[model samples]
Target: MTISLNKTIAYTKNWKPTFWIALVLGVLLSLLLITLEPFDNSNSFSNKYFILSGYTLCILIPVLLVHPIENYFYTLQTNRWYIINEILYVVSTLFIIFLFSFLYHFYVVSGLSSFTFASIWDFIKDYGVPFIPIVVPLWVYLRSKYGVIEVPLYDKENHKKRTSVTITGNNKSETLTIFESDFVFARAQQNYVDIYFNTESGMQQKTFRSTLSNIMKQLPTAWQVHRSYLVNLDYLTAVEGNARKRFMKISKTEETIPISQIYYRALGKRLSNSPQELQN
Candidate 1:
């Protein structure tokens, strides 16, 4: 839990911490419920507080369980029903929350009272409506304190599209093929295209007698940022400076790609400064 407090997890690192946090949240919620007085008008203030705490425990239990399940959701293999796993997580969480709400009302508030969907729905609304003002700040604080490095839940096959492109020479014999993800950027250099790409060691370049336009057809993550330069948006980090001049920075490189006034506006509109430039 300490290792990933900022990021959402199923449970806290220790039972003590979980108990303490839950107690604090539960006390605050009890206060809120006391303020609202959304219970049987016949119940006294003391009884109302007691009843609200039971409902609060129900909310906390499901929250603790759901976060951990969601945290590990990205590990599901894409070929083996990733979408189904995601759906199950959501459905199961909702079911648990609703079940707990109904049970709390049945056992504690009203003995075998006629439980209806409307009653459970009202409980859900009261429980979840304060999420923005309450939970969002808590979420941000946890993330800032624990360094919540969010792992994107994109399908493995979708995130890294491993495509093989066959590059052919004028002679029928010579050919070279490359994966699209490795490509960084390409520049139009005289008659040949200077293809810059990422490597295990560092940035590497290859000269191919190919037009930038032709090479771009194979690169889905690439965009024509300038007349001379085509940038692979996947590795792109930021665009700095004013409209007069701008610098485009890519991941793992101190050097910045120049964006000309000719293409600066277009590049700004088409690509974001974030690394997930190709993300939908």
Candidate 2:
């Protein structure tokens, strides 16, 4: 269905996981190459292990180098990530590794004199075609292990119901009581927390001399999406950017609060299960 096709799935742009995945894949592929003795590698002057190491580098280097470029494009289409995008990423990564493998064969496995258009075509049929069957399953496994699913938003009539809540500070008289639904977000600025909320007149801010954690205690419904920011899920409008970098937009505010990677998945789950719809 069109709805299923358009549904967004989580995409991780964090380099730490990417590095580990590439390293593990490289090691596995190297081991396979050693076991199968694929290609006429015995004829080469280099040691078998040494040539295998070159192939490992061919896989590792391309993934590390190409990921940043992929991340750049992912950021441009942040919340729109779908299965098709992930498929493109996998295909592009394989193509890059294929090119690197071709170069490795041309310089290390075969001499410069052997280079020819037909040689490249032969390499594809001999090497690239076989690589896909092995690599595609690995990619599929990695994606299923790491990917997050988005939940459908359902209507809730009481989402905007106002309930009076009081928030206090470290010092006496530094206190505020407002309708919970009107609270937008709070930012920790050194010793003070700047609270933004909606008012009959417009948006208003109240500075409380308290730590973010202390403020969070009073506002149980609020979530700390970043180290310095606490947001009311009721006001959350959209989440933008990939897993590496993300921002949260609040209703009635122009400022976009940064969402830390540590809290990204939790936030996604919270929004996905929330009574209100999360606008992309």
Candidate 3:
């Protein structure tokens, strides 16, 4: 499931110093471009401040939009595998910046008539031409942000919170909202994960199409018992069975949770030090 920044907390959680650094660079570069007039095009003394304002807007607009996109992009980057997420984030954001720049050129700077494909290409190129020399330093500064902490600062001790996690069913539009604690366990069934949780009536389940490994890291209180199952540590009642086949059971749910040989010992150690409060 793809998660996005919903509020200011999410923004602060995802943002880094590098973003502010990028904005500062954007401002300084705008100033430099306005002062030097590198290309030496027809610009008299009277129009200097006007040219400065245009350059400042051009940098500020894209910088503003790109950073927010980065907030969501980093969420994807944290949840998914690096190679896949990086490619998607980069390509998507580049297009976003281009689209923003295009609109800025059309509606703000030049008229809609001058906003053809050729003009847009020329406009982006004009922006890039000045950026070529400083690109390396910008890359070096921004690269550090790629590995920024996704852990939210709000709950310093425990990142876990009662959050609304949406589960989209077979149909893309069909969805259900479940509280984090109510969710019990998930099992991999073919191309989807069959998620099980508790309700006032009884235990309910929903099918979510996603890799188990990906979802494993996403759930804060969940732990993998077998290759197929991820159980909530909060609901876990006791570990049962013998050396041949160890299994775990949860409160109010009699469903047999198998503890495979791989995760068997690790599960024991984890539960050993687990807070007794959750066991209540």
Candidate 4:
């Protein structure tokens, strides 16, 4: 049952910003880091290095760790829960940074005293505290441009013309000649998309060297009814329910597509909104 909540999630998919916003944020953060208070006996050059290092470790680590986890949750279509996980991951990363710094000073960094609760608390307040919160959203924004949170879509709006796409696999190149109407569905098969389509003669299958999300955008306005499946909205002629999956009956074909539970709502909504009414 492709239903309400799923449609909401699909519409919000691919909420990535333009490149200019990322470029501006990067410049601002760099400038902010350059102007922070200096430590005693540290030259401007060395201070810059310390700030960069702190920013990288304290800020970047959390982002790097959390991004994959975020994607996993997004694939599961658990949007709200993923947001919660991101917040907890960021907070936890900040604590880890503080703990590691204290340990380093005590056991490694010379000219520093043994770790203490008061010192650790002060260090967190001084450095780890201010930098962590500022970095997560900026990183998320930048990374989203790379297709991180995007969902797959295909439908009639893109069905007219033949699209020539190059597919490379095993260091070899192959050309995929397709019209948006010819495609029935596609799936992310490991590093590639396993595509199902139709020709003037009969059904056909091909492997393409691209992700499902990337391929989805090129498709006509079909909704992604499963994390792995992108079906042509026009082809969805009938839907039959099953305990685990809903079998989708497509136009002019008896082959039914499987609709995963996660995408049911989004797919249903797209079907309800006649594809002819959707603006290209």
Candidate 5:
């Protein structure tokens, strides 16, 4: 019990810790129940054993129900089936545990010719209480840490067509035709985004809507290194880190975009861990 509780508390810092903990506890408790000699020579149900049995049910049943139901609520649509799902998880877990307990109890009775429900239940009550709350903190911590909430894009029109936007500067209104493929990088400045792309002549610049958050979705899977900037993961050539700052160098571009310190670790991890890049 002590070991299970301690591991649960510590492991809750990461995702799915309770699930791992519960599996271990279930096996350990079952083994202990099976091996320990029952003291029910009198063949009478005792309060001590009753409590233990209740606890055994508590440990496995709630965890099974909680994990699946929690995942259902978190990912899938919350329908009337949610309550039913919870019930099913609990019942299924209990049914399985009970089957094992029944088989082991029968083996014990057959082996020793002495066994009672009280003794079996006692072992259960003692082991199950500590495991229930372990699920909560584990779920909460994991959800908070890794679940990035994404805002759904409101796609009103199915615009299969691609066109160009003209950039009007102080002197001339240069009409630039940009194929979505040729465009490399873009940054928002107030209501305008200075777009950088390779042209026939050389590199060309243009200004367009600053609300590229929607447009960005149309682009490839790129990491938003900073609030103001998003860079193509493939284009990222080298990551430079100093005492206080970090920057990423994009291919075919000399300008090094600054990456926020908060995202440095994540960016570095992604760069080092993920494949070279899967170009869509």
Candidate 6:
């Protein structure tokens, strides 16, 4: 269990998803409060709506503030993010929301004048205890739905030394040879792999009656970015997109290759250390 919790997972850093998740949570919480009529003192519908707005803001403000701050730290040490990190993020954000909600309740809903430690403790029992059961599971579900696992970085130096590579098909006679530096990317077709490489004349493609995995073993520098594509890091020029959707651009090719989420972190880390110019 400890080892499982310590395993690394993709940390969501994009603001768009953060905003949407907070918005949805706020809306849902507001609706639940409205239906339940949790606060009997706010009997008047207008007052209830105003109080609900405060509750919604409490949820939204903490989440939006916490996510970016956490993301900044995550960026500094990208590889260290794990399941435990995510759990702590969610719990810390919830604690902040609880503090905000407690203050709002003390000043506005309850119309209390004194702000004491005891009152805060009392409010936690009244409010925070009930919220945990519902919110934690919901958070876990959302995280699993959106999260991705990161792959470990490959040795970038291994690919740099090799100048030429020979890819062989099922038959010995079927083979294509090219300079390793000139190799761009490879895509798997039905039963053949299309190899793209640079030539003095122009960019060229050679089809081999072989699988992508078979081709990958021959090229030490090639990385399988997706199920159907293997890219040569030597030719990778740019990487773009948010946590959910990412694309890579090769130096000599106009085509953009889709990067699978599992490979995204490893690719970014590899490119940042590479001599090639990588535009994110």
| Top lDDT model | 6
Q: 1-280, model 3: which lDDT tens digit per residue?
A: 5532211111222445545654665576666766666544426435655645565455445555666665565556442223344445445554555566567546654435544678778766876455645643564446433443222212213424567676664567646677777778999887688888777888898777776765655564455567688777667667789999888887757688888765565556655655434333
Off by over 4 Å in 4: 1-158, 161-170, 188-192, 209-223, 242-244, 275-280
Q: Model 3: how large is the Cα RMSD against the reference?
A: 10.6
Which portions of model 3 miss their true places by more than 4 Å? 1-19, 35-42, 66-69, 73-91, 98-113, 129-133, 136-147, 151-280
The lDDT per prediction is: 0.57, 0.73, 0.58, 0.54, 0.48, 0.74
Clashes of each: 1, 0, 0, 12, 10, 0
lDDT by residue (tens digit), candidate 4, 1-280: 5322222232122324323433444445445655664234335343445544443343334334445655565556433233344445446654765676555434433246565689888766875567656755664555433423233334453556576443344434645666656677777777678777778788788887866555655554435666677776656665679767687777645666787765565456545565443322
Which candidate number has the best TM-score?
6
Question: What's the residue-level lDDT of 61 in candidate 5?
Answer: 57
Q: Is candidate 1 or candidate 5 better by lDDT?
A: 1
Candidate 5 lDDT for residue 204: 74
Who is ahead in TM-score, 1 or 2?
A: 2
Off by over 4 Å in 1: 1-24, 42-48, 76-99, 122-147, 150-280
- Local accuracy of candidate 6 as per-residue lDDT tens digits, 92-163: 888898898899887878777988888898788886778778766776666555654443344356444557
Off by over 4 Å in 5: 1-141, 146-181, 273-280
* lDDT, candidate 5, 1-280, per-residue tens: 1121101011122235555555555554544444452435424434434433433443455566556545554344211112244344445555455545544444543345555777566544543333335443543454334433221121222112244434333334533556544565767675565667656787677775544453344443323565466564455667797848888887657888887765676566665665443322
TM-score of each: 0.42, 0.53, 0.41, 0.42, 0.40, 0.54
Q: Give the TM-score of candidate 2.
A: 0.53
Q: Is candidate 4 or candidate 5 better by TM-score?
A: 4
Worst lDDT run of 10 residues, candidate 2, spans 149-158
